[model samples]
Target: MSWRRALKDTARSGIAVEKKRLEPLIAVRGAAGLAIVIALSLWLFGPAAAASSAFGAFQAAIATFQRSWRPRPELAIASGTSLAVSTFLGYLTISKEPLFLALLVVWTFAAGMSWAAGPTIGLIASSNVAIMLVTVTLPTSVAQAAGHAAMMIVGGLVQAALIVLFPVRRWGAHRDALADALAAEADYARRLRHDPVASFDPQPLMEARNAAAVTPRQARRRPAELHGARGIAERIRPVLASLADPAMGVPAEGPARDRVRELLASAAALLDAAAHAIRHGEPVKVPPAALATFRTPDTGSILAGAPYRAMTRLNTLLQDVVETAGGAPQDGAPSGARGTARSAETDDRSTSGRAPTHPGARGTARPAPTTRSRPTFLALIPKALKAMRSELRRGSPVTRHATRVSAVAATGYILGTWLPLGHGYWAPLTSVMVMRPDFSQTYSRAVARLAGTVIGVAVATGAVQAASPGTLLSGALAVASAALMYLLMRTGQFATQACIAAYVVFLLGMGGEEWTQTVPERVLLTLMGGFLAMLAYAVYPAWETPRLRTRLADWLAAQGTYAAAVFGSYADPSASNAPDVRQALLTARTARAAWHAAVARATAEPVRHRGLSRTAADDAEDALAQLGRVAMLLEAHLPERGATPVPPAARFADALRESTHQGAKAIRERRVPTWDAVREALDAWETENPENADKVVRNTATLVLDTLTELSEALDTAVPPMTLDGTAPEKPDGPRNPKDSATR
Candidate 1:
């Protein structure tokens, strides 16, 4: 985590190109929108107006490319409206430097704080601030500024209209997200056949859940196949794990193990077929081999008890998947109508009780009909305000980022104006474009921005010199550059920035700037702006390394609650506990995702990993993963509602919850958790009705205790007393070097 190593990694990441499939059709649509705006403006208002209008179209096109579940036209319209408002307000203050600078600070700060909502919102908001800096200077009078602002709105409307008319792969992102989740489960099932204890990443499932959240209007128009399948896919993961796990009593090497392998392989095939169908809108094709494996009976077989029950549930869920994937009827109802009901029944059966003695029996508690709803666009205004208010605290990263960006923007503008640069706004524009909330992004973007600007400016300059293109040709070239930008949008920052630079160059040429004057000034101002951004981050940084322990503690606490909820559901198989269990699982997944992201960001920071070393962190994460897996196995074999309730499980659940809450507090204070309460509860249970409890519950309790022990031992390595500066205190033996065992 030294500065030199961090710099090397960030630089490499800055230039790395992602191998994403290019959506040429979508690119063509966006370019056509831009072309329409430019051609109309050139015919009516000339090149100056065309140049100003292109910003709206170009920005709206970029907004469509963001990873969001919202409608694409909505995104374009929102981006255009916001950019237009900023430009008009910016024009009002352009006559007074102090007022304009004050407005710049407020706008940029608001843009930075928008990260609290999500990256998509933050990036679009930031682009508005940057574009505002340039667009405000395009008009010379109040009347002219009003015209420019009106044209900006027109540009956005045109882009939105084009998207509505010629849609490319509508809801394509949602399909891919849901399909990826199922595909991930399919991959996990295959891996478990060989390595029973293999860990599965929950990121895909999390993304699928996000994609599934829909507005009421969207729900009415959604594809039939996209509904309810994700919930089934979630249930399949644990069943696959439990059946293959040797701890669940499947013999390591026997006919039973062989049969389990066949079931897993068959499940994988079915899932793959379902994924392909959903992703590409093709018909689901069931493989003959998979159908045969599912039909294999457990009669006269070595697999019995827990394994037998898991086999039954797996077959039932896969049937649901097949039925749902093919848009077929389930129990004489259309898949769309019965999808939620079947998924709810499926989850209730999995967690509420054991599989029915026969397929005809149902769980005691039935889930009410439900619909997924998300905040409407209007509702988001208050939600965004609340998020911004929460981020106003001193410790919030968003607040720090806002302050940093505001200061850098004002400084860049003042320096630009004082240094006699013809276009002073380009300096602040570059800074706003490159600065981010984290150290790695801020530095990497600075590098990428400078490099891209140099290449883009040079290439455009050479072209202009060779072609000596007039205003009309310049407008065409700008549109072409925009098309290229859209094509390379997802590739990497370096390539996107290069295209943006070229687009800006030709765009300005339409406004009658000579290539000789514009190109050199842009390159020099961009370099200066990038340098200021990098320096500002180094002076006032929000390093993720210091927050690694906090993130880890949060994950530990969430995992404990999830395990408790699973046990509670078994102790009392009420419909209420079912939702609690589902909610706990979701909370744990979110925490785990946050922890992983923190670790990834911290790896490129120059600070020491505050409390946890690299090896200790890995060990701790593994132990937590095992804890979740054990809970999942127990969940797969929950008892029937009328069956005997394990009363002792209720007490153990409370004990686990309290113990982990305390343990998390200890973690934040840089101490190893003793887990005394959990150990005592286990001992009391073992001493009191050890023989009366279900064998599966007893065995799973022991496994949970073992994982907790592993966790405590792993954290012991990170318990060394440390100074405020993230370095270990001197001991009798020696002082620990931060570089030797870094947290990342």
Candidate 2:
């Protein structure tokens, strides 16, 4: 049903759903490329060295998937270096068990703890696996070990070739994120049209924002382009939220409502166009009539004041989006407004500073892409050393996780070596592969690893029985199987390559003298490895249950800060508060991202000896999500009080201040606090300033009140104490889900 809906939506949207359609084909093409590389290498090296070269192909395939999301040039560098380094380390350590073991502990510890530094560091650590494998081949001949390690590099080169020669659309992730944000806007618009009284969830839009910011690879290669789109996306969030405010009366009904919805739909279409434009480097075009209503709003409709304000902001932002996306003025925005918006965008770009190491992917472009000098290798050494020191500091997640991973790997290796299967490498391999920083990912991957093993074993055994494909065919098939795994890796279907990996493993082993005894031993070893990884995590968690509540508090404080900023902005927009607003939003985004990470851990966490149950944790997550929308609404519809006389700004500023404090206090105290002060402030403001209480101001006050009430309910919902034994202490733990009581 979802697929059918997706198809219908794609057809309705008029743009080709190319990414969704091309994933499988990309997988096949990438696999084919890797296979060709391996096949050619095997031919050159001969069957005597097939196993060695096949290992290279395996590494290359894994590296290809790891680096695939990045731009072509960066992918080449990272993937190439990773393969070479791991292979070099792998070969150098062979026949030296003590050295191999030492390297294993150090590398695994480094990899597990590397998350402290950042994404790129973390990626390098997690993906480098040759060192561990090299340890397993202890007591092997130097020539044989070197040959296999060298093959890995050759395999990586093949994968790189495929990316360079037949690259799929670059910036698919960025495009998808932009599309998602636009979709979110459209959904919000539709929801406002139907029911403005109900609370909304900002999670979808937040997820989109998070995805774009998750990596900065695109930023490095094309900061000017990608950041411009990101800037537009971020800037538009407030405007959309404002549109949702009932006070804005964007489209209560009639032609005005239709025009508003039409504009929103067109905005979504514009996003689609921008996405395609980024990929193809073409000018983004929109229907000339698309945002006509937004460009020139109704004169005497319900959109007189607030909607007019919305329409004006929309004009500014839409023009800015088109300009940054290298799009044209096809949306029929006034020429004067387009120029103004472009200048505004440039001003933002000029003032926005770049991030350390990687720049922010905020979707807002600066006046220009500054020519900041890239840090040289020597320059980065100090920072890298500093980061290492920080990670090794007592009780850091990185340090704790690293120590845990090292211990587990050592234990797994010892157990494997003691088992007499001579394939003990499988245990440590599984242990290293499965153990990650977060319990959720660790457990999930453990399940995937085990499931994939079972499936791969079954499929490989059947293939072996079905066809004796001879030496050449088996070797080629092995490379192809490795390629397939890399190809399907990014699809998030972890099991997609299980069968292929299994096929490669079985096929590679078949060439050896002990071929008959290989499959069963491998199956057993794989299971052992999976069990060990899962158990290690259970014994020593990288993050505790209490951290979940701590993260939630962080999010609560973040929203409180944002709300306070929004309130202050509403009270006095002319004041130099732009930096405060921007910083507040950024802080909130960071906090939200952290909370999201914590929630993910909670989900993947072992259910026993934890903080809140899944249901309670989920409720807390939902509450925060709802609160985010309200906070955003404040930012969006915050009435400018400098030049224009927004009487409501003065009326609700104190109320908002009180509410923000109360809400944060409630979240921390684990109790629902009364918002009597907010109501009192509102009452006093309205009573003292009756003449200022125009319909618009009154509606605005009502909106703020609704938000506070929702905030109160959110804290109340999660405030109830939860038992550790999975039983409810008092009432049924919160709601079954946050949405059950969504309508505050």
Where model 2 places Cα greater than 4 Å from the true spot, the runs are: 1-25, 36-50, 66-69, 90-96, 117-124, 134-151, 197-227, 249-302, 319-328, 340-398, 490-494, 510-514, 542-545, 604-627, 637-744
| TM-score quality measure for candidate 1 | 0.94
lDDT, candidate 2, residue 679? 65
Clashing pairs for model 1 are none
Q: On residues 342-410, what C-alpha lDDT tens digit does candidate 2 reach at each position?
A: 333332222121111112222332233332233443455477667878778776777877888788888
The lDDT values for all models are 0.83, 0.57
Q: lDDT, candidate 2, residue 307?
A: 60
Alpha-carbon deviation at 65 in model 2, angstroms = 2.9
Residue 437, model 1, lDDT: 92
